[model samples]
Target: MQFTAKFNALAVAVVAAMVSQVAASPAPVASVVSTDEFLKWLDTTDADITYIGKPINGSVPRAAQDVMVTYCNKRTQNVCGGTCTVYNGPAACLAAGGTACLSATANVGFCDRGGCGGSCNQLSTCGTHLDNGFCFTPGTASIIVPPS
Candidate 1:
């Protein structure tokens, strides 16, 4: 009887701790980044990336509808000066192939990194770089409406 009572008390304490943890967790944030800001931010991050393709019409968040990001997924092979290199992903592939890849392509879709999450890289403040945080999708991201 005493053991049962202690077990129940421990369970209650565990449940209370879980509830408090959930309540203390922070919420997700979203935004729409601008072009000029992106360009400047690009210089800051100095990421090795290039335009791969466009985003497919998947369901976009209402707040994010005005702007959407379509990351590319191009994996192919390239012969750089007789040295063949298997390219994996459009951005990296393009950067490797350089001008030679501008006219070529492979395949693309929404870039899902199994990451924690994603959000918009608003102007004035640049978000994370491609692959690391913000730029999860690798394709081209255009603003449906100018940054507000």
Candidate 2:
């Protein structure tokens, strides 16, 4: 009976170790930002945009009915190249006139270490990173609107 108990404990320990390793692994970097993250980014200033983790390439915007953003992609490999805005989705950002915000280009990727395209030399701010996108700031007010 004692041997059986010991075996059970050992098995549990092994399982626990395996679980911890899986949890620690990085999440598959998103292809796009979630709706909630996009909305939050709108209200955030340039200094804090990285808080929700960078948006991965090919992410779809979740702007609301009146939100807008300016996206730029120097690489030109994706449609989100240059400035754009969110249109409709989980967090669609609409304009004050009730027009939809511009959707980010379909091909843009989040600016990460690898995606910077080796042009880090000229960057004083994030502009050196060609893939970076910015939500137009003094962003839309922080009004609590229901999700679409």
Candidate 3:
């Protein structure tokens, strides 16, 4: 009985130590920003933005209708710059040609092939995170849009 009690006390202490360690750890940062926030950043950035599929006119609110994804060919000081294409729709496979950086309002998958057939990685697991929630996705051939 004494041995069992001692083992139980040790186990409780171990569990308490683990819980304390977890509580002391910092919370993970969210890789994807909100649609409104991403659009606001796009407005302020100097990167030339082009719309793919249907153009976002003043008649429609972009966030309500479409998932916006922006891909660029340059990365300067953690910023996605150069000529950037903003794909504004729920496309199964977005051909991100020669993309060096990417950002999206929603979490998507970046693939190595044009048709999203090759090895893919989630935007949330971005190896190199850039400024304004962009990911340094060099050689990204396509982006797989998640269904709404």
Name the candidate, 1 or 3, with the larger lDDT value. 3
Q: For residues 40-101, what per-residue lDDT tens digits would candidate 2 score against the true structure?
A: 54555232121111333335633333222333221233222223333332333223221111
TM-score of every candidate: 0.29, 0.26, 0.74
Error of 2 at 41 (Å): 1.9
Q: List the residue pairs that clash in candidate 1.
A: 71-137, 71-138, 71-139, 72-138, 72-139
Provide the global lDDT of candidate 3 against the true structure.
0.83
Model number with the top TM-score: 3
Instruction: Please tell me which model should have the higher TM-score, number 1 or number 3.
Output: 3
Query: Which residue pairs come into collision in candidate 3?
Result: none
Error of 3 at 90 (Å): 1.7
Off by over 4 Å in 3: 1-29, 57-65
For candidate 1, lDDT tens digit of each residue in 99-125?
Answer: 121111112122112221223223213
Off by over 4 Å in 1: 30-43, 46-132, 136-141, 144-148
Candidates ranked by TM-score: 3, 1, 2
Once model 1 is optimally superposed onto the true structure by TM-score, how far is the C-alpha of residue 97 displaced, in angstroms? 20
